[model samples]
Target: MTPEIVEISFKGNKRVPYFNPKEIKVKPGDWVIVEAEKGIDLGQVNKVGRLVALFEIKGDPKNIIRRAVDEDLAKLKENRKEEALAFTVAREKIKKHNLNMKLVDVEYQFDRN
Candidate 1:
């Protein structure tokens, strides 16, 4: 049997391939939580199809962690709000400390460790 694969982009256009172990139905632009290198992460499905041969795959194939739920999206929004607040506070602290430094944009990580 041909193995199915899906392309999931973690950020921007950085798409990675994974094996669809269960073949849970999914479509492009679907928000899916995937097993990323740094634990589980949320990503968008870019493409879905089957590969010619199993050996044609590279590295270890990861399965979709699960389709994102309402709770997951809510948590993601809340985390984003908190991240913005933290960035603002960090900038303020730098000013208060009389430090001459310019702060840039902030990126939220998957595991945030």
Candidate 2:
């Protein structure tokens, strides 16, 4: 299937930034990858939409794209596993190294890809 170019927005402090899905292209029903603050995120397209032109934003909206595909979902799943593993390893390392810092809260994004 031909890949459809779309925009994926992520939550930010001031304004959300859009990501380009150059690695994979997807459809409304398929899962897609989105670059988030914490790490790569997985989401499905709920609607087919385009980026509205905003001169103040600067750059081209063409840089922002989104798509859905199976591989993207699989990769996201693997990334989650890896992230969990990394966290565990980090915790162990911290204890072993006796770091003074205390662990704070961990958050995960559930929507808006």
Which candidate has the highest TM-score of all? Answer: 1
Give candidate 2 regions above 4 Å deviation.
Answer: 1-15, 19-62, 103-113
Which stretch of 10 consecutive residues in model 1 shows the poorest summed lDDT? 49-58
- Candidate 1 scores a C-alpha RMSD against the true structure in Å of 4.1
Could you tell me which residue pairs clash in candidate 1? none
Which segments of model 1 are wrong by more than 4 Å? 50-58, 92-104, 109-113
* TM-score for candidate 2: 0.46
lDDT of each: 0.74, 0.47
Q: In terms of TM-score, how similar is model 1 to the real structure?
A: 0.67
lDDT of 1: 0.74
User: In candidate 2, residue 97 scores what lDDT?
Assistant: 98
